[model samples]
Target: MIISIIHLLSSCQDFLDEKPSTDLVVPDNLEDIQALLDNEYIMNRNSDMGEVASDDYFISKQEWESWNEITRNAHVWADIISPTGRFVSWNALYEQVFYANVALEQLDDIVPDSNEQVDWDRLRGSALFYRSSAFYNLLRIFTMPYHLVNPELGIPLKLSADVNKLVKRSSIEDSYAQVIGDLEAALDLLPSRATIATRPSKQAVYGLLARVYLSMGDYQKVLDYTSLALELGNELMDYANLEQGNTFGFKRLNEEMVYCSYFSSGSIGYSSDTFILSEIYESYAAGDLRKSLFFTQAYQDGHVKFRGTYMGNLYLFDGIATDELLLNRAEAAVRLGNEEQALEDLNYLLEHRFEAGKFEPIAGISGEVLLERILEERRKELVFRGLRWEDLRRFSGSQYEKTVTRDLDGEIYTLEPGSPKYAYPIPMDELQLNDMKQNPR
Candidate 1:
C-alpha cells in the first residue's frame, strides 16, 4: 500500500507504513515492473472495510469488542477518531495506485524487441487494470452513490509517479470517467483472457466496465459491456460436478473466474461467519446446488458456516467471474423489457446452479414481477462476493427499496435505504496530510 511515499523496493522496508523512510528504486525494465505488479500482498490486497460495513455478515458481542476502535466504530456506522486507521482503507488502495503509477510512467521507457512485445503489453495492461480496480474499490466506501455524489467529495485521483505531488480530489464524474478510460485502455492492450486469473484480461476489463456502468446507473451500457465480456469468457462453475466433501470446493483460477483477488479485514473473512444471514440461507430451495456447495454446518455449535468462496480456500473474494456478468446482463435485459432475453439469461444461470433433474425454468413471468424474481436470485447467488452492500444501496429509494438493520447485543444499528450514512468517512489523517475534503458523516 503506498503510504507517505511510494517506494520501488530494493529489499524489505515496508514503504506502505504511514511513516517510513526508504530508498525509492525506479523499476526501469518490463521484468522489474512486472515483478512489482506481481507482488500480491502490496499490489493486490484491498481494504476489507466495504465487507465490514456491508450486511452480508455479523460479528458476535465478544468479537465486536475485540475489534479495534476504528473497526468497531465503522461496524456501527459511527465516525472514527482517525480516518487513516486500518478500517478506513485509504492508504492501502493508494499503495496499489502508486505501484500502477510507477509502472505506467516507467514501463514505456523499456523498448522490447518483437518477441517481448506481447509480454510488454500484458505487463502495462495489468498495471492499468490494477490501478482502475483500486480506484473503484476506494469509491465504494468513501463516497455516496453516483446519483448523490458531489463534485467536491470525490476521492483523491492520483495519476502520476511523482511522490511529492499535492493531493487533490477530482469530481466524482471525473473519477469514474478516469476509471473507464483506464479500463478501456487495458482492454485494448490485453489478450482476450489471461492464462491465469491473477492477471487482468480483456474479459476482466469488460466485466469491470459492466459493474462500473451499473453502479453509475447505466443499464444499457452494462449490457453493452456484458455482451463483449461474455463473448470472451462465460464459463460458469457447475456445483453438481464439485466434490461433495471437500472443505473448500472451488479452486483459484477456476473456469468461471475471469479475475481473482483477495482482501482480509482482520479475522472476519470467508470462513469466519458462524451464522449465514437467515434470509440468504433460506432463499435456497432444497435442490439448489448453492445450498450444499456454498455452505456447511459449523463445528462448534452447528450454526451454518460459509465454506465455499469462489476465490478458493481462506480468502474473502472480490473478483470478476462469468456468473456475475450473467446477472448484470439479465437485469439489464429485464430493464430493457426484453423478456425473452432476460429469462434466457436467468434460466441459463439457474439451470447450472441446481440439481440436474430438479432444475426448473422460470416461465410466463413478465414485467416488474419477472424483474423482482431475477433480482432476488441475484441477491441469493452473489452473496459474500462483496456485492450485497452495493446491491442494497442501488435498490434503495427505488421500487425494490430494502432497509438493512444489524442487531448487535441489545442495540439496533440500521442503515436505511439511500441514507447519507451509507457513505463512510475518509480517514482524517488523509484529510489533514493531503488537505483532502472529508465525506459528510
Candidate 2:
C-alpha cells in the first residue's frame, strides 16, 4: 500500500512537470512575467489607434470630405465607422489598458533576488506608461475638451484587468487626473534609457506629461515638462543626410526621440497612405527639404497620388519626438505672453529645418501675426506626424478660420471650425452598454 502511494505521488509530480496549455500559462515567475511586456509592446505597434488619431485621418467622414478626395473615402468614411473600421480607436486603446493593468498587477509578485526583478520594474513602468498613453488618446477622442471642467461627461476609465466587470464613464476631470497619476508613477520607475525602442523611459514619461498638460491648457506644466523632455531627447534628424533610399533615420533616444516603437513592413500602410493632407502639399515652399523627404508626387493618366513618407517608417522607428516639445513650449509661451521665448523655440525648429544659418529671425512680429506664423510653421514641420486635427480641435476656442477641403466621389466639401459635427459621436456600443451621455452633433 505504501509503495503504491509513493508511485501515485511520483505520477502527480510528472504531470505537474509537463508543459501547461497556452491559455494556462499566466506568467508564474519573473521570466514569465517579463513576457507580458513584450506582448504589450507588440500590441502597441499593431494598434490602429495611432493612425486613426493622426492628422491624415479624420474623426468623421464629413470632416474628411472637407479635407480632400482620396482622404475622404479612405479615412473619413471607410476607416471610422465601417465594419472594417469598427471603432478600432476605442477598442484597440482599451485593449492596451487591459493588458497594462494585468502586467502591473503581476509585477508585485516578482522578488528582488529573482534575476528578472529589475526587468520586472522596467516592464511595470512601461505598462503604466502605455496605460496612460492609451487613456490620453481615448480622452482626446471620446471626451470633450479638458477645459470644460465637467466631470459628469468624461470617458469610461478602465483601471483593472477584469474584462467581465462593467465600467461606467468617469468625468473628464477624473480621467485626466488618472492619466496624470499613471504617468507620474511611470516616470518614477522607468529607466533613463532601454535596449528596446518599445519600452518607455523617464524622458518618455516627461514627454507624455507635456502633451497631456498642453491638452489640458496648463501652459506652465507644459513648459516644465517640455523642457525636461528636450533636455533628455536627442537632436533632430538632419535633412542634409537624407538621400533617396538611403538610411537617414532618426536615432532612438537621441535628441529627437524620447521613446520609440518599431513597425516593419506589415505596419506601414495606415499612416503612409491616409494621413497627409492635400493642403499641406499645396502649402510646402519650394526648395524645402521637407517637401522632398516627407512626400512624393506621382502622376498617372492625369491623376496624382501624393504619397507621404514619414521619416519614422523608413528608419524602423516611430515615437513622440522632441520637436513636439519645442512646438508645445512655443505655443505655451505665446499663450502666456512670453513672445520672445515663443519666437526662440519657433526659430530653433526653423533653424534646424532650414539648415544652419539659413533661418533668419522675424523682426518685431507680434499679436495674431506671430501666432499665425507659428501655426503655419507647425503645419509645415509637423505634417504627416499625426497632429493637425488635434491642434485644430484644442485651439478651437481661438476662432481660427482655417478651412479644410476634401473631395468625395468627385464632390468637394468644405469644413470650418464651429461646425455642429466638430466632435465625434460616442460609439453605439458605449451608448448601449453604459449610461454615458453622447456629444451633441
Candidate 3:
C-alpha cells in the first residue's frame, strides 16, 4: 500500500490539480507511516522564495533579463505570475503537511504495547514537528509578519489527509498559534536526540521553536528555547580549520546542524550568474575567515558568489543549527536586558569564525548597539541560508528596518518597510481552486 502511494505521489507532476492524497490506500503499520515521513525529498524541502527575494545576492542584468517571469518578478518584489501556472514551493510544502497528517491520523488508532511505545511516541512527535515546520515556512512567505498588529490572511491549514476536504485560510494569529501548539505538544514525545540529523528530536524541536518565536518577536521564548537547545549540543565548526578555497567548504549535516532540511533550488538563488552583493562581501573584517570560506570570485570583474552552504551543494540549507541558536540567544538576551549573556554568546560564536589568534571579542556595549551587532553578525554568518527575508520581514518598522532595492538598466525597484507586498500573492492556481484571499500587491 505504501509503495503504491509513493508511486502515485512521485508520478504526479501537478500537485494542486492531481493531488497525491486522491484515491490512495492508507498505510496502517508504524513502519509504513515512518516511511512516509522519511521521504526527505518530499518532506524536508521548503520554500525557496525567501532566498530568491532576499538581498544577499543579485544576478547580472543580462542574466535577470533571461530568467523566467516568476523568478524575475520575485527578485524585484513585484507580484509574481507563473508562466507555467505551477507553484512548486506552495505545492511541495502542503504535500509535506499531507504526509504528516497521514501519519498523525494513523497513529490515533494504533495502540502500542510496552516494546512499541518508544517508536509510537517518536513517530507521533516527528509528525507534529514536520507539520509545525511546514506551517511556519508557509507563513513566512505567504503571510505577513506575526508582529504586525493586524496581519493579513495566512495560508490554509490542512490538518487532514483528505484532498477533497477544502480548508479556508486561517487568521494570521490563529496560524501562528497552531504552529506553536503543535511544537509544544511534541516536546515530551520526542527523544532528547535523534539517531540522525534529519529526524526530529527534542533538540531540533527546541531549535525550531526558537526560530518560530523569533519570527514572532517573542524574545523571552526565543531565549528559553535557544538555551534548552544549546544544552543538548552547541558545537560550532571552526572556520579557521576549513579549506576556504574548496568548492564545498562545509560538509553536509556537519557538527553545527541541529536539524537537516533544504530550500527548493531556484535559478535566482543557484545560478552561476548570481553574485553576492559587494556591500555584504566587503563587510567581513580582515581577520574574518568567512569571507574566503563562504564566497568565491566567480567572475573576472571581482564579483563574488556564495558557496558556503552546509548542504554541500547548490541547495540552500534552511534547517536549524547551533550557530543560529547562539545568535538568536544573543539577540533575545539583549532585547530582554541580559546584555552580559548576549555578549558572551555573540563573541563566543564569532571567535570560531575568525583567525584563531586574531579574533577580538565584541565588548563594552548594550542596548540598541549590542542588538545591531548581533544582527549584523547574523547576516554575515548565515548568508544564503534562506533566512534573510524572514529577518527583514520581522524587522519591519523596527529600529533595524531595511528598505530593499534592485537596480536594472538605470531603473530602480524598492520594497519599503511594512509594505503589503511583503506577503507575496497566493499562486494563481491555488486562488482559482480555493476561496482563500490573495495578498494585496
lDDT values, one for every candidate = 0.79, 0.62, 0.86
Q: Which of candidates 2 and 3 reaches a greater TM-score? A: 3
Model 1, residue 146: distance off in Å is 0.4
Write down the TM-score for model 1. Answer: 0.92
Candidate 2 residue runs with Cα over 4 Å from true position: 1-24, 40-42, 46-86, 114-117, 148-150, 245-255, 261-278, 298-318, 355-357, 361-363, 401-405, 410-422, 430-435
Task: Write one digit per residue (lDDT tens) for candidate 2, span 253-355.
Answer: 4546656643322222432333345566667554456665555554333222223334343433435776777888888788778899899888777666654
* Pick by lDDT: 2 or 3, better one: 3
Global local distance difference test of model 2: 0.62
Between candidates 1 and 2, name the one with more favorable lDDT.
Answer: 1
- Candidate 1 lDDT over 70-100, as tens digits, reads 7777778875535444443777788789889
The sequence of per-residue lDDT tens digits that candidate 3 reaches over residues 43-130 is 8888888788878887778888887787788889876656565777788888889889989999998998899999999999999999
Q: What's the lDDT for residue 281 in model 1?
A: 78
Q: What C-alpha lDDT, on a 0 to 100 scale, does residue 338 get in candidate 2? A: 85
Indicate which candidate wins on TM-score. Answer: 3
